[model samples]
Target: MVFAPGEKPGLEQDEVKLQKASKQIVQTAILRALQQVSQESQQRQAPPKGGPSLQLERGKLTKKHEKK
Candidate 1:
């Protein structure tokens, strides 16, 4: 689109294609993370009043949250 008369239009087409691809990649990463957290919450039960399993599950949740 920026070309003068007689110049090739290939570079302009490449720029537009690159911009769309970049946006698609970023949005896909965000949605995948959201899906993981929701899935984890569904599979887990409430922690025992107090025990090692409770502590370990809580620690795992914290680590997964930190990863994002």
Candidate 2:
């Protein structure tokens, strides 16, 4: 149970390493969650069923905004 005065303890070093590893793991998980949420938000913001699906009356819309 005794380590030389100047020598580092393996158990303590291992615990420090594990702490760093866990922090990295948590950070990566948070990054992934944020990315997924952004993707879902973008998908929801996209036009439904892709492209314009408007069924405006023939004279309802002005020529200024036509999809042509």
Candidate 3:
């Protein structure tokens, strides 16, 4: 392909549009990744769901139907 004087090759309007679209795609991916990281950090900082755990002490229970 031949270009007129003072004309830069490989930088046509279509190429500029393509470059812009590629940049936007990269930016969107980065933004999504950052959002995911932020959400994970927030979840980690949040408290655990449900009530506290239950524990049994030593000798706390006896076998049922056992003779005295």
Candidate 4:
């Protein structure tokens, strides 16, 4: 099909749109992966909820044993 002057062919337009959509999808996937990795790293760096409590309990037990 012949396009008028200064107009793009339908197939060219469709290809451009497809390229843009694929790029966006790839970007989104990369961002999600990075976010997941960051969350996992943070979780590893942060202590568990039970950590402080366990430490406190151990300290108490030590004091009690020392008193004997």
Candidate 5:
């Protein structure tokens, strides 16, 4: 493609602008994904609330039937 001398600079500037915009878009997407993963990991690390507590009793395994 033969571009006129006056149009060459404009085309170059447009190409640079497009490259910068695309880079910014990709960076933003990556940042958002990282943040989401960090949040999910934090949630998983948190302990459950109002759940059954586990304990180890040091005695024989005998079941005492309770009168209900």
Candidate 6:
């Protein structure tokens, strides 16, 4: 389709506007996904709080001898 001489620039401007809007939308989606992944990773890496502590002792046990 051939547009009138005056209509060609308008069509180009509309296309440019559409492209800009699409780019903005894609950027927003990527940022949101990245933020969500970061939050999830942080949550997973965090240690649990208020838990019991464990201790290990190294020793040798001696058996008691009983005499009749």
Candidate 5: tens digits of C-alpha lDDT, residues 1-68: 68876776478889999999999999999999999999867755663455532332475544434455
Off by over 4 Å in 2: 1-8, 48-68
- Which regions of candidate 1 are displaced past 4 Å? 1-8, 45-68
Q: What is the Å distance of residue 23 in model 1 from its true position?
A: 0.8
lDDT of 4 at 43: 69
Quality of model 5 by C-alpha lDDT: 0.72
> Candidate 3, after superposition: displacement of residue 66 in Å?
31
lDDT of 1: 0.67
TM-score of candidate 6 versus the correct structure, residues matched by position: 0.57
Native-to-model Cα distance after best TM-score fit, residue 1 in candidate 4, in Å? 7.2
Q: lDDT values of the candidates? A: 0.67, 0.74, 0.72, 0.71, 0.72, 0.71
Would you estimate the TM-scores of all the predictions? Answer: 0.51, 0.58, 0.56, 0.60, 0.58, 0.57
The local lDDT score (0 to 100) that residue 64 gets in candidate 4 is 18
Best by lDDT: 2
CA RMSD of all predictions: 8.9, 10.6, 13.4, 10.9, 12.3, 15.7
Candidate 5 Cα RMSD (Å)? 12.3
Which is superior by lDDT, 1 or 6? Answer: 6
Q: Write model 6 residue lDDT over 1-68, tens digit each, in one string.
A: 78886787478889999999999999999999999999867755663455532222366434334344
Candidate 1 steric clashes: 0
Task: Give the runs in model 5 whose Cα sits over 4 Å from its true position.
Answer: 1-9, 47-68
Model 1, poorest ten-residue lDDT window?
A: 59-68
RMSD of 2: 10.6
Candidate 4 accuracy as TM-score: 0.60
The number of residue pairs in model 6 that clash at the backbone is 0
In candidate 3 the C-alpha lDDT for residue 6 amounts to 81
RMSD of 1: 8.9
lDDT comparing candidate 4 with the true structure: 0.71
Q: What's model 2's TM-score?
A: 0.58
